[model samples]
Target: MKPEDNMNIIFVGKRHEASRVLSLNGTVAFVLAVFVAALLIATAWGGYSIAVSQVEAREPSESELVAEWKRKLDEQKEELAVLQQNVQYQVDALTLRLGEIQGRLLRLDALGQRFVESGLVASDEFDFNEPAAVGGPEDSLSADSFAAPDLTRMIDELERKMQDREQQLRLLDQVSSRQKLEDELYLEGRPITWGWLSSPYGYRSDPFTGKRTWHGGVDLAGKEGSDIISVAGGVVSYADERHGYGNLVEVDHGDGLVTRYAHCKTIKVSVGDVIQKGQVLALMGSTGRSTGPHVHFEVIRNGKSENPETYIKRASR
Candidate 1:
């Protein structure tokens, strides 16, 4: 027996035959129902997804977030502005205080300058900003240079000047004390008080004689028998005059100061009598060449007869 032909059942893709039409129809119907149901489900799912996407898209956008950020930025800007204003105010106040301090410093500097000019404070011997110099030759500053100096050196210079001023003040006090001592020993007068001026110096009419004459002294009018005091402490230069200045007494105060009193009712001092300032010299009266009771006063300096008024002011002061 020959090998039987292998029973082969091969199925290939083909369209449906008409002999099994019912079965074919039933399968087609089932497939169509399934396809329709799947289509319906797919369409429903796509529509739901599109609606959800639309809802999500309708929520707050980036523009709204950007607007919120802008508002926050504006608030921060306001806060920054407030802080800046506070800082500026503080700075301005500080600047004002600095200006006031500078003004006070300038005034103090001016006062220091005046003190130096008045010889109350001594000034620095050398410029602080200049280079060191010593002994013999004088050196000059360079015109083109701006100098930076040591603060320690300037402080040292100030201290030296302060010491010098302290020394000067001590010497000034000594001189003042010496002057007061000499003034106490000198003879003086009360020229302004106790009388009124009646006559001036130079040529004038003689009041008693009614004649034109040169007046050698000034007349101090006061009541007769008024106190006539010595002008200075000195020995009696001349108690009796030769003529003109009748009943006159002259006292020679040392150091070129002399005083004379004339026209006295009675002389209390003699030729050799030593007189002190404020001691009674005579009594005022119309004793010689006078119209009314008065005192004739004269001051001679350096052998020249000066006006008594000038010396009278000094003595009164």
Candidate 2:
């Protein structure tokens, strides 16, 4: 084919003056085609650039990868250490609380023993030497591992319960102590274990002189040589013969109270002897000015003679 490097064109109009002609060159058209082809190649190469960027993004440097793994491992180790420390602290706190609970339980057991020995109660199940008997069915919900906050809450609740129990035990101990003291000091019993109230106190005709006179005590008639015992716990202040009061025994109970036993066959206790209630002080017999085997019992309060009938009547009930 021929090159056809030159081309022409014509335009005609109805009017003779409106005619025109146009022309084109082969070199200009060739240059334009070449420029268009180069632009298409460059656009295709930009896709290759995108592919290269994707390949570079897929491969990371060895140091950068090692640094990333190290950071993650360090974070994990730190978390594990913190968890271990927290667990250890909880264990230590629980151990201390357990010790305190054990001590309080020991004290409670000792107090219970004291009450038992003092005859305050018949028996108790809170024995110190024995472990508590406890058993129950297992529950799936409670079998899970304990969380830190849950364990701490449980320990605190137990501590509060133990403190409350301690307060109650102390109150019980105080009450028991007061009861023991009352049992020891309060006097309420007859002078003789077995006897009869023969002559009342206040007034009577004297057995020796047959004259109406004031009698300071009551006369208890019983078998000869019968035991004459104290009516209350006290210290013996006197135990000797007197002018008209035969072989006499006097006891000084605390709180300005005293007791006297006269006309005894034999004096058993002496001065300074610590005596208990119902302790044998002498033996009843006819001695000095007594007519027969009898004991003259006197209740003295604050160094003055009082009616013995009131004390004797009280002991009967």
Candidate 3:
């Protein structure tokens, strides 16, 4: 190599005690440059490898990622199933409630029909067999779906109908009770089922003493042991022997009205016994002051004896 082509390098010690000189030709310099470049490349490559290792430690592996995805899918499926079950339960409960309401409505209809048949209300006015008449102009905003809210509204409407029916039934009951009271209080008909009026009220000749006396009641003669019925519905007040009566039965109707059956062979009712009209009170016989099988029937109003013939002539209710 030529002297000019060779390069000189100098090295100095830290203490400046000694120095060294080196000479490099073109082939050697090229070799040294190549070695330095290879060292730098190796250092850079090592740094890049460390950075990739750190990133891999921070992130999850492929298996872990797949497991996490599977768990999330299972959880979502469970939530969906729970939601579906809840929706089904709600639907079933609403359907059951609707069925119960329908049953109640049917019972109300039956009751209303009975009231109508009993003549409490006019059949034309309250036709329980037919559905209620309802009509309206179709609204543009009408609902198309029978959702929970629509079901709730229908239940509310049914409850309102039930309230209306209950109110009507209460009124009918009141009317029926009043009519029953009137029928029990109004007195009519004869004391005996089969008999003839042998004696009347006012002046009559006494059979035992043959003397003219003011008779207070009428005498109905019948076959012995015939039933002596009550003329009205009342409670029995007396059913024992009296001064001129044997086996007597006295019934007190309401409103200060009463009836008496005397000279009975056998008393069939006791005191305080509530009885209906035409109920047997006793059996007719020749007892007490009676001369034959007869019943002394008398009606009293407000402590005054009334003419029994007037009540007997009234039409039966």
Candidate 4:
């Protein structure tokens, strides 16, 4: 059988009846191919449209990109500004602290200078006008920069040193003052300006009695009315006449030490008068029980008499 060129269809239904004829063979195949091609084209076109929409949704627009960059840049700028402000604040705080430290240093220097001027220490040794001498080996890691914490530690250490120095200076001042007071109270020297040890202490022949007697003090002979001076700084406790010792002046040098001046023609200081070393206390003369033109000087410690010659020799040295 040959392939049919045309085919007939008849349709019968309750509502209607129809009859038609269609070409077959190659045309049918051609139509089916065309349908398949069109279906594929439509499917591919739909898939392509979906893919394009997805891509458009995923990618950022130009304005959005600019806004994002602007937002990031603004955040960075704000952070930088805050960082700068913090640094400035730290710098200001450091500056103020440094100023305070400088003031403390100045005050410390002034205190040191005052100590020097007060003669607490030798000027050349504890010289406050010049920088203190210090030395050290070069550091191998010197390249590292000092941070704020290091600076703070240095300041703290410096302040501690200042405090220690202040305490030391104060102690030195106290010691010096005590030494000066001791020096002032220590008795020494003779009572007359021009005199010789005419009569030595201890057993001696009395000039008037022509008999051996105990002498508590040395006789310093001089011209009549010669100045009789005190040998130590102290308050006068007695300045009056006595039976054996004529016009007398006695000084209390504290710490159980006392000095007595006897055979004076005139008493210059009175009781309660403060007398200094080498100050004139009376005039030498032949007064009660005795010789001429001599001042009898005596030193008493703890109510016991001590030889005045020893002190006079020490004071001369």
Candidate 5:
């Protein structure tokens, strides 16, 4: 239909019909169409085969995938171990705290029991299981907030009180003992009491003298050989006859008190011998400067003479 389509060729070698003009346009177009169609079909089939082979060569299978999962499992296991260790630490901390609280409870219980014994507080007031009483905004806090080391402090207070009580008891015992000792001293240690003086020092009637006369000792009337007693606790100063006193006895009492027993029928104690109150010294007698048997007694304090009658009156009590 166009000028380009008019190009032609003749096939002359086969026969007279072949010697006709040949149309190249139609044959060429047809061959070109066939070549293009074949190239497109072959390219599409090759691309499809390449895509299928890539699919067949795809990544690992289930076994390898499971190995990877196991790796992740191991990591998680390690993480769990660390978490368990942390949990154990927390548990230890809580256990320690619980132990501390239990110790405080035991202490509180002991303190309560002791309080009941000492009559300081009631046992019911210190129950540990009950909620702590709140005295203020933060009174329910730890033990330090209320009663801490105050537990042992009460021991000191009680010790002081006990010492005071013991001291008072000792004082009472001492006073009672002193009173008893005083009674004994009054009864036994008195000089010249409840007894008559048979002789007095430095002048007295000699019963022989019938007339008033200067004498060295006064005669005292008593049954011959009666008991002659010491008036106080002391050592014997002399126990021998000298001049008018026959078988005389003398005692040196402390604090300058002295007594002489003259005309003793017999002497019982010697010099430097300790004697207690009411101890027998000799028998009563009137052996020296006497017309009849009698005893003589004398009391001199610090070399000053007092009436033996006065001393005898006091000793009677």
Candidate 6:
């Protein structure tokens, strides 16, 4: 190589008396440049390899990613299933409670209807056939939200109260029924609807014979064809013509008590017929030994005649 073609470089360092000179020809410079480029490329390749290793360590594999997603999905599904189960349980409980409440309400309505039928309360005042009148403002202090358990407890308390009320009503009904029965059986009032006492029970002068005779019953004089009602509830034992009394209607009450209404123009009742208090058993007329349109009322206790005035004056139960 020619001396002029070679390039020279000098390096001077402090504290070094000698300087170093390096000379490079065309081939050497080309070879050196190629070698430096190779070193740089090696360094870059090593750095790239390190970076790739770090990325590989940080990121997950495809299979691992799929497995992780599947696990998360399974957990979500389990949580959802649990939530659904809880909701269903609450619904079932609420449904059962509601059904019970409906049944209780129906029973209460029936009981109220009985009260109306028994005449314990006026139908217009307490109408069981219609819904009860109720109105109230929304309570601000009341809970706005209710859980399933809270609702269930409230329903239970309501049912308990309803049961207590039902029992009380039943007791009242029994008492009322007893009172009604007593009232029905009680004997009071005169046999004729419109009448005045004309003859008294005991010894009296007979109109036909003009002789003193024993009178078995009292006579109540009224208009002809007037109503002859029963003084008490009983069953008619005889409702036909008798020897002395005409068209006699004999009612046999319970407890060995009996009553007789005679001298009727028309007999309205028959034997074996049930009679109620104030029921018309016949029509007033002058039949048999009766002087005028009058009813002969007789009260008997164990087949013995008694003064009917005592029973007529007594008040009904």
Q: How would you encode candidate 3's per-residue C-alpha lDDT over 1-317 as one tens digit per residue? A: 44337667899999997899998986777777789999999999999999999988897989999999999999999999999999899889888887887888787787777778667779999997788899999889867878877777888887888888778877877787678767767798888889899999999888888899988899999999999998889999999998788778999997899899999999999999999878999999877877789999999999999999999998976
Could you give candidate 1's per-residue lDDT for residues 179-293 as a string of tens digits? 5435533545543247888999989877777698877778898888888887667778887643656678888777787788887887888887877667888888777666777
TM-score preference between candidates 1 and 2, better one: 2
lDDT of the candidates, in the order given: 0.69, 0.83, 0.87, 0.84, 0.66, 0.89
Ranking by TM-score: 3, 6, 2, 4, 1, 5
Instruction: Provide the global lDDT of candidate 6 against the true structure.
Output: 0.89
> How far does residue 124 in candidate 2 sit from its true spot (Å)?
7.9
Write down the TM-score of every candidate.
0.40, 0.52, 0.63, 0.49, 0.39, 0.62
What is the RMSD of candidate 3?
A: 9.4
| lDDT string, candidate 4, 10-90, tens digits | 556666756444545755656666899999999999999999999988979899999999999999999999999998998
At residue 29, candidate 5 shows an lDDT of 56
Q: Write the per-residue lDDT of candidate 2 for residues 208-308, one digit (tens) a residue.
A: 78899999999999999889998777899999999888899999888888899999999998899999777899999877778899999999888899998
Compared with the true structure, model 5 gives a TM-score of 0.39
In model 3, which residue pairs have backbone atoms overlapping below 3 Å?
A: none
Clashes of 4: 0
Q: Which stretches of candidate 3 lie over 4 Å from their true place?
A: 1-151
Give me the candidate number with maximum TM-score: 3
Better of 3 and 4 by TM-score: 3
For residues 69-117, what per-residue lDDT tens digits would candidate 6 score against the true structure? 9999999999999999999998997898789878878887887888887
Candidate 2 or 4, higher lDDT?
A: 4
Cα displacement (Å) at residue 268, model 3? 2.5
